[model samples]
Target: MAPTDVNRSTAPLSPAPAGGVPGWPTGLTGLGYGGDYNPEQWPQATRLEDVEMMIEAGVNIVSVAIFAWATLEPAEGEYDFDWLDEMMDRLHAAGIRVALATATASPPPWLTARHPEVLPQLADGTVLGQGGRQSYAVTHPLFREYAIRMATVMAERYKDHPALALWHVDNEIGCHVPRDYSDAAASAFRSWLAERYGSIDALNTAWGTAFWSQRYGTFEDVLPPRAAPTYANPTQQLDFDRFSSRALLGYYQDLRDALRAITPAVPITTNFMASSGTKGMDYFDWAGDLDVISNDHYTSAENPDRHIELAFSADLTRGIAGGQPWILMEHSTSAVNWQPRNRTKAPGEMLRNSLAHVARGADSVMFFQWRQSQAGAEKFHSAMVPHAGRESDVWNNTVALGQALKDLAPVKGSTVRSRVALVLDYEAWWASELDSHPTQALRYLDQAQALYKQLWLRGVSTDVVRPGSDLSGYDLVIVPTLYLVSDSGAANVAAVAERGGTVLVTYFSGIVTPEDHVRLGGYPGAFRDLLGIRTEEFYTLQADEQVSVTGTSGDLVGTFGADLWTEKTHLAGAQAVAVYDDGALAGLPAVTRNTVGSGAAWYAATRLDEAGTAALVEAVLADAGLTGEVEAPAGVEVVRRHGSGGASFLFVINHTGTDASVKASGRELLTGAAVSGDLTVAAGAVAVVQEG
Candidate 1:
């Protein structure tokens, strides 16, 4: 039977602390379905109906004022809060919480018209047209002033509003283009370079600009490296990336400080676009200012592995906030409107995806819209109530999911305890791509995604940790595509390996240092001795070239692309786990394992395919004595949350279309199910298995 959606009374909500909201709500873990709510857009008479429908579908919170800049401030010197005041009042009356947002993402038409300097310039010196939202540059002084003003106004006005729960900062700050090379941007870039290097000589040394006579005579000569074709210098590009990230941080900090002044009680967050170019914005720096880190995740429904990416994104946010529960600001209820083939989410996919986030440590869940728009860019975007309103199939599905969330409120605030951490570095991502390599097809995200899937299938709790994380407790640490490794990062890995922890280093790792400079002496620099291998020469092959490597022990076979930076290495103290069986450099080491100190480090000399990566991951985990610990069924996902209570709650979610067989050894918290052997779980089933 489809679950009947319940009202706010059953929607278990964690209250704010005595003084303020304590470290963001982490409880009765379930999905909260409502996004981009703008009651101001609809007639006042229609609000009650919307609220009734929302409550029936278990939507406890609404993300309001996403792009209301024009309405909030029609002119430069004036502000209006009449519509917003009424909207909040109506939500309060309906017992619905509000994710109050600063309507500064899209500047008012009048403000942009009056101050065109707020607009960003493209990389090739072309000025960006001011029509779309988030078109302004982060460093623009006028943009900063108006943005801060809007944020301050919202914070002060909603500071005491009982309905205000979470603060949604600027909407998708870097949605559009990346860096600009305008005169203003160039001036700011030069100042940033001056602060970073202190002098032109140091700058030259870092970029190795002397090789191409690109040495700067003065700081003024350094501009945002945006010119295309033959003029793209990777070193300059890296600096521009760092500069843009800092600039975005400044904008975020400005609004964060403003919100802090009035509403110190509620958490503030900005929704980050999950997959995008220009990794300039450091999520760590941005997350540090937020009470809860929120993200806008839209994935292809056709790909079964999309859930893995979603889990990875959630883990990334959790890592940034030190395991604080996060919110999903936008997710398509059925299918995405943006993709060419707008396929509807399968019968059980929506519920499955929602539970997957909970399994990964997501505290709150919401989508892009509650009701569909009649006409706009997102008119066709899937929502709780489609264009067909409450009569739609999507609406029914949404209502059923809401009822499930309300029933699972007892599982909220559960903490996740992970045994494996995959090291994902943005600096390495930038350095690897910025270095002009042989294969343009080598995608860093895809490689990281591949590794994540391997860990997921092995029933290991995994997290995408940053470069400098505490790796003492973890049994296995997987570092994929670690292209740029600083001395400190290398030291951390060494410590982990020396302390009897297994470390897996993949291809394209340890090529460059932190300052965008190539490591001196040998490739993989500080890690060469630890890895027990030295790579002297490297070559690249075509896209179709296959790398066939034979394993030394297990009949495990490995295959990967030989088209990207194929390295020839001599194993010093490491044992050859796999060797290239068929290639010009046949019988050479393609995969090696080195036993250093009390632990071991496995190095994959080439990028492996899905099957190959899984095998390698299984082998690594087995050697570390940490494989298949959590015995779960084929489609049933298992997750554990640990915290101050000294108890762990394992969530077993069956998001499959057919009945799933699930078995556990812990006491079942939701039902009095037996804690032994396998049990059949109905479609869209969720079970909280607790282990004290």
Candidate 2:
């Protein structure tokens, strides 16, 4: 069954817009469906067949020219727009819009060979050679000049094309070449440092240069933290990570500005690798600059919990978009070519996966490519049309998903409102696990995914926001393993509790500043006042060691296990929610909850086991007034998206082995079945309802 039609417009499909910019494309009226189109790789006959197939699959948009620099300008300063023009014209004629790329993701061979200085270099000073993608250093002057020129040229040529919907700046900006330590990068880093610190002495103080007499005499004397005799400076490494992320963002701005100056009406964005696969670029800093938030996700076939991770990625992307509807720019239609063992999808898995993204907040669903490549490194990658052509499940699923999205037109422009906020700071994620910490077992995403997964399994939607965000509207705020925080940012989190909201802070958080300087007085120094607890020292447990904890008195009741960490924690004014029953800190408080103003602040001194975490989470949810009945069966998932006029669309996904049901009253969009009080869902299937 496909999605039911939600809108009765004159045209069910959309073409490239002719004018003003909207949240989505001006001309599109329904959920978007398409994939990447590399038309230059095929002949004219094949291109025609691809267009016909797209129409049959209900594709309304396609991303073109992402890695077409080599074809667009095979020679220096010489250009060819013939193939792109033909493709754009043909797609528009077939009612397919284009998310046009600048073709600057990778430079042409001629340019790279002519200006070898633009090549990226490793930390050991090995300059990367050509023959791969993303070969150019972002901060290299020549590379920036060439890429900016490329963006300007493409904007000038396609400014009037009818197939232009969105301007895809560059494909996955930091996927391959996230960091470079070349001479150009060194210069840029120095300039960035100078701007940030203003003086050499200030920079030395921030970097803690007095410890080993490593202070620099001038800005020019500094270099990247390259392969040294031993471990490099922690603060220097932290600063470079910040500088590199800024440098890439600056490069994107350079291109985006050029495109905006020429074509002011078209929206521009770049695909972000926001999934667990990438961690280099701080996407929170990149969100404000985007006209639309887009992300690419790939799940491992080996992970039994891949669906939960997908839910996390989608929710995090939607949060980055400020809870607005965004696009799923690229995902695998089946087994991807990159994993160690690429296993094909089971029956009905693809449909469930696509709807899961839509349930989270994706207005459009797209894949890596439209047709399976017969040649190149990604030839083994799955696509909408596999080598088996129309008979393959991939193609059949693609067609089904397309019609399903078209039927979800009413869901377009709706937003997902999350009352819970999970603080996720990229800088903190980078700094928390840096060398020379309390324990090597401390991982930022590990702690975050653990908490987020529990919430997901409970059918509770979450918003992953940057630390220091305004938490006024949220009833529950969770800060997980945040090792770095600014003073004002910490105050902002504290104010959340001051306003009668429940706040949960985990261990190893609030330990450092932005410059990697340890917070003085005590561990979790920033939140000590709010949490009403003091931690004297950290106890790092061995791999095989485990600890036991038990709940105390009223409201908090459970006896559970923990591992990998402990702390000599003493309660200041708060009561112990859970106390360590066995460990170095036996009989001391492992978890405490302090009433602040009218709200409460809870702290965990160690990583609790699964049962303990779930128990604690349940109590916190009750404290925040979020407790409720099971809306769906045990393994079934339910999320609602709110639209205008109190209208909501309920998405129910059944991941269990047998049939399950949830209570609701609505017209089912997927099967056109009427649901009243009880809604039945088959195993491993999905349903969407326009709830009244």
Candidate 3:
């Protein structure tokens, strides 16, 4: 069949106003409804059919040429933009904008075949083969040279194209090849350490080499903490992780600068993986390098609390962007291909998930690819258009979601206002997870997310912030297991309590410096003055063991179980609010509260279960003089996005199997119907109200 042409039309909606972030590219109008469009995978006739289907589904933007490196340049100096030009022109004629990717993520076979040294090496000195994507070493000079040249060529070619809306710089850095333990990596690590510590003596002192006789005579003597017979040096391993992240960031900066020099008008972004644990690169450190923040989120099908995890990732992404609206660059429409067992999404699940991202402050919702691949490693991955064509349920839901986003276009520039801030430090996460800890079961993200989940369940919006970020606007601040604390970070937490604000610090916190060295004065050494307590010893428990906690005063007047880790704490001046009921440390304080200046600081010396955590969070909320305005039913989420000049949009989402009702007054944006008094939302449905 021959390809058919179509006429161009204006965008469905208007561009969102540039929020506080200045120089934000203004090409996108309305919600962007599209995914990665790789026309190179299909025939030209099929490509035309895709455009028609995209127009039918109201997709206005598509990311193209993400992995087209081999096709874009068959030879070292060869350049070919003919096929790319045709696709761009066709999409422009169909009223669809393009997010042109640099196609430098995976270098071509020819380049790697010529220079096998570009391949990354594993910890055991095994060179990675070139069959998989992201196999090149980030520190390789030739790799950077080629990547910059490819990006520069693409930027210069598409700078003035009418369909170019945004520039996607090399897909998902540090995803597949986060670290390399080769000779090249060792040299780079030594250089990074020299810049950080200047002298070998300073490095030796920071690493505490005297304990293990691992002292380095010079920078060149240090290698990337590779696999040893026994356990590797923890401080050395931590520094290698930091160096690896910096090397990848250097590659991203090279490509970003190349694009910025050629196409200054276009916004540049690279999608970040906001997973629960450490993803090698600290997104908080990398967030500033992006013109617009974007993230790729995938829900765990096996986990029952997947929605809450999704919401956590979205909120963290928005917080990293300084509370500005971010882009949901990729999400599965149904089931993804990567998991051990891929479970399909239930009815209305897709719509609920996309709106969930928007409710948390995402301006655009997209996916990995537009059509399901017939072959490849991700052939089983679901897409906007499934294998069953336009008649499939995925297509129907896709169209419905498109219309829903069109109706909710007014939420584009609105900000999600949060009164509570939860400190998220990547450095603490890295240092706390090092080998040889008190308890390997204690994870940084798990403890932090547990408290954040409690606030979310109560319909209380909170922002995930860095440790050193400004906390003046928040009423309450929560720091969970912050093992690595710099001087400035500790001062920031103290300032929060001194300014008539409440703060909560959990167990195993403030135990180390930024260099992964223990503070040594007492446990939680950095926060002893503010918390008014000092820990004598750490009691690590087995998986099944738990200690009972009995409250003596305040809202914690009941029994709770504490597990994983416990600290024997003695209060200096603070009053004990909760005490251990049964254990060697019986009658000792498990929870303490102290007044600092005008505000108060609370410390939890042990891990608390769900109910206990919720009780503690509620008590802190009361201390901050804040409460949820609307009491929502179980499995239903309530959030508000505030626009300029007192206008607000209330998002009520029902993640339940049955219908739910809430008392509110406003006009529902989805249906344009008036909602007064009691509003009933259908099962797995969403109701966004525009309120004054």
Clashing pairs in 2: none
* Per-residue lDDT over 1-692 for candidate 3, one digit per residue giving the tens place of the 0 to 100 score: 11111111112112322443232435678877789988888988989899899988888888899999999999989978888999999999998888889999889999999999888999988899888898788787777788888999999888899998888889999898788987777777887888889999999998989976898898888988788887788888888877787788777877877887777657778888986843688788787778788889999999888888888888899888889988888999999998999999999889989999999999888998899999898889999999888889999998898899999998889999888999988878888888899988978887888998888888889899999898999989999989998999999999999999999999889998888888997888899999999998998889999999988988766889989888889999888999999887889999999999999999999888888898899889988988764789988989899998888999998999999999888899999999988889999999999888
Put down candidate 1 lDDT per residue, 111-181, tens digits, no spaces: 77878876788876778867767777667666677778888888888888888877788887777755666
Across 65-96, the per-residue lDDT of candidate 2 in tens digits comes to 99999999988788889988988999999989
Model 1 quality (TM-score): 0.92
Clashing residue pairs for model 3: none
Candidate topping lDDT: 3
- lDDT for 661 in candidate 3 is 93
Between 1 and 3, whose TM-score is larger? 3
Model 3 lDDT, residue 13, Cα: 15
- The lDDT per prediction is 0.72, 0.86, 0.86
Segments of candidate 3 deviating more than 4 angstroms: 1-25
| Cα lDDT, model 2, residue 506 | 92
